[model samples]
Target chain A: MSGKYKDVAYYPGCALEGTGHAYNRSTKEVGKALGLKITELKNWNCCGAMEVKNVDPKLQTYLSARNLSIAEEMGYKTVMAPCNGCYHNLKKAEYDLAHDQNSREVTDRLSRKAGHKTYEAGKVETIHALDWIKEEIGEEGLKARVKNSLNGLKIANYYGCMYTRPRHIFPEKDQGPGSESTSKPHFMDDLLAAAGAENVDYPLKTACCGGAHTLSDSDTSTKLVLNLLTTAEACGADVIATECPTCHTGLEMHQARAEKVFGRKTKVKILYFTQLLGMALGLSARKVGVQENFSDSMDLLRERGLY
Target chain B: MPIHEKSLIRPENLVTHEHLEIEGVDVSGHWSTFINTRAVSDYNEQMQEEIAALPGGEYIHRCWQCGSCTNACTVNAINPDFNPRYWIYLIRMGYESELLRDKDIIWQCVSCNKCTYACPRDVFPEGVMKATAHWLELKGHTEKKPSMVFDETFSEQVFATGKIEDGRVLREFFARTKQSLFQDWLIAMVRSLLMRLPVTLMMKLGLATVFHPRTRGWSKAQAAIDEYVHEREAAARKALRLDVQGAE
Candidate 1:
């Protein structure tokens, strides 16, 4: 709108505020480089996620609306969420407030608790931070930051189901519309493309990597992980990449289970968006928070001759 | 090098929210309280929901059921038998056993929030979906949700050294899980009998191992972590500057 978001509105949600801080960290860095400013939403709270909105869809709508409405009143029109979950919740609130009168009424009631603030649903544009970065930075801009590129990379663009699905919040086209969909218009894919990655056709791009299920149902989660690795292996992908911390955990942490299932040694690795981004930018592993991973990305890089 | 020929098949239903009823999955009642409330008194109530869910989720009230969650869900996208939308809906009703029983599907939420993104209602279904997994784990449900397994070790690692010692965390996690990675297995087996620890202990416990690495100045790191966490908490409070009329 202003050429670039000189002052971008940021919502880290609760998880990103805490353990999932790395996403926020990477996003801020990348956004800043692209001339998009990242400003923390004042008095922002959790989206009541990790709880079932299906239990009380109204409450989910209400709380999420209240947060966004607050942002609207603060004069912020663009809501940037690093967490796909947050992005969905915030965007959904906006959409609900727009179409459902009941939701608006309830949101108004919730606004009472805001100590005297009101929210209008459509007052903001909610998008994953990645979407805007690609728009602003473009391939040329990203190429400028390239001190290094992923050469000879057998990189897999593991969308992990979040990047392209739930097309309501994201542009419908981003989902690569139609049943015969192959490569999604996934921003992560674009990001990988910018990094000079050769995207392997990963079937589990939208497949569940066994999120919290890994904790509640290890055997099941293990199977899910097993499937993911097997799928990536089938695609001949040397490494997998993603944007969410939870997704990262599911794919990497479940490696042991995968090994147990196949009864063979496994060597696949999982990484955060920044880890791969850093590699593509010719940055060192530590700069992209590589040491924090369970499986080393270096080994994969070396094996692929990308290092 | 493999050539990844881009498919002409369009990705039409990516997390497309279609109303679904996963038969055989049992749970009666709808989770409408979180959404119907209209308004919360303040931010803490909202955060309370997130923290309580912890390792699982913070976006409990975000689902508007476009089937985007189910559609985008890795498990569902791959295996419709495991639907996140249905699992989360069950959670909305506080259907504990229903969620616990699937044990596998409940843990299968994959934390991507594609459903959350597409709901058109911003109902981060993934948060509560994950939280349900945590709730299952807290209740001593043996089902190991992918992210929840890290919860205990992540917390313990934090408490033990004020910072995460990845090596220790990983080793501790495997030990607790009963999976012995070579040497770590032998140590866990020996420790298992030596401690006379009950089987319930093994419920969260696993085979022991020294596979995880530890830091040299863990005590300093621990203190720093505690101090930082406290400071962050204090800062949050300072930011809220709460105007409480009644401290019930």
Candidate 2:
């Protein structure tokens, strides 16, 4: 890799492995173009995500630590995650290892409960994908290579929670120097700007798009989604862009309820940042998984001759 | 114009105009790129690769905007706009301006664990919100009214002395908030004479401070603590960047 990043170890957590595969595929395609080699980790398992904690708080961190331990065993120092759930879990494990000694003890107990080894203090570094683009690629280089540029694309940047909330527990510094050090502060924003897209900051950027809420309370989830969509639409966003697969599914697929519940209507296209970046990179619609989304992002793609 | 009556834009008009904020500076207009946004697509491949390298970013590609987290949150009941689901989606999409303006809602979370509990896929939406809030806490202190007022003085005091004495913190807070001098004086006098003198006299008379050893080498202790935190933060940042870069 001629760019700043030489090689990378890619960890596509469970969500991406099964449901969120589009992110994995598109990311690989895009990464290759950027002069980075993505090597998938072997025997990578579920991140023990945020759910197990509620079900069994005792086993929670241990389950997450197992994933980290796997990375440590593989001799991988750094791992990247596409799902906010995976990011949060991995980040939490890292946080526990660093500051909370009790957390280590708890996870160690779980390690014995599950019969897995205890994760050492400061075992491995876990992070979201956004920080990588800003730190390694460097804005100037990334922007310099833009091909099609999705300029004039009125976009709403969706954060979907796990990337940048609860500062005390966050794993990384956000928005430092030219680097957007923090989480979800536009892992795609910088790329969008580099690609010539008009990224509009909607007040609802941090607004929950109701990722997991759909299962337990569909209507409430729908209400939250509608409010965010309504606010984003009000902000003049023609398209809503996001990183989390669950958030993407919620925001785009649920537009009908969002329209009905809020008594508001919008034709705002919702697409993954990868899809948008693929558009910018001049990838054909099919190659970038445009049809995968419920929204007719194809229309947006076709309008730009991206299809 | 007849006697002017401000007409609030109805829901119907929201589609025609949209509000956008950059660096906390909000603006609204017809959904059009005010700046030459042509830079967006030029390097998607490179950024895509960079984004791809992060471990969890793979799901970013799968994100379909299902409103699960917003519905899962108890905090959203109080403020209808606190959406973790949307924020992560935006971050994956590279919307920096939206994230910057998001400092308001990031703080609304009570961390009740409902959203995390409700998430079907175990997408811990709260973690990223915390990360973003931490990001803001660093520089966002200058932007936030509450943090700006006294976070600095409080931190300086704590950094100088290991713990925050409530009296000291409150006094600095009151000063920063610009409370009237007489009001503060009255409260301070009442509290000091009524609640504090006994405690203070005991300490002064060496009855209370039996174990309160004078914090000798406090600066050295402070430096060591600061250095350790800085190192941990640095390590975390390094790992985060590595993950981000490699995922692509």
Best by TM-score: 1
Cα TM-score per model: 0.57, 0.55
lDDT of each: 0.56, 0.57
Q: Please report how far candidate 2 places residue B188 from its true position, in Å.
A: 65
Each candidate's B-chain TM-score, in sequence, is 0.47, 0.49
For candidate 1, lDDT tens digit of each residue in B153-210? 5554533532343335446666787666564323433343335434543342232223
lDDT by residue for model 1 (A1-307), tens: 3255556688776555433544556666656545677778765555645333422344556556656765677788777777766676776676677787866765665455434456775578776766666655666777778767876466676655544555554443534332213234466777777777888877667766656444445666677777778778788887787776667656665675455454644566777666677566665565554544545566666665444
In model 1, which regions exceed 4 Å deviation? A1-6, A171-183, A260-265, A301-307, B1-248
* Model 1: lDDT of residue A307: 49
Tens-place lDDT per residue, model 2, B68-185, is: 7788676668566677777666565555544555566574454445555555664555544444454454333324444323434544443454333334444666677665445432
Cα lDDT over the full model 1 = 0.56
| Model 2 chain A lowest lDDT segment of ten | A50-59
After superposition, candidate 2 runs with Cα above 4 Å error: A1-5, A112-117, A174-176, A179-184, A259-265, B1-248
What's the C-alpha lDDT at position A108 in model 1? 65
Model 2, DockQ value?
Answer: 0.01
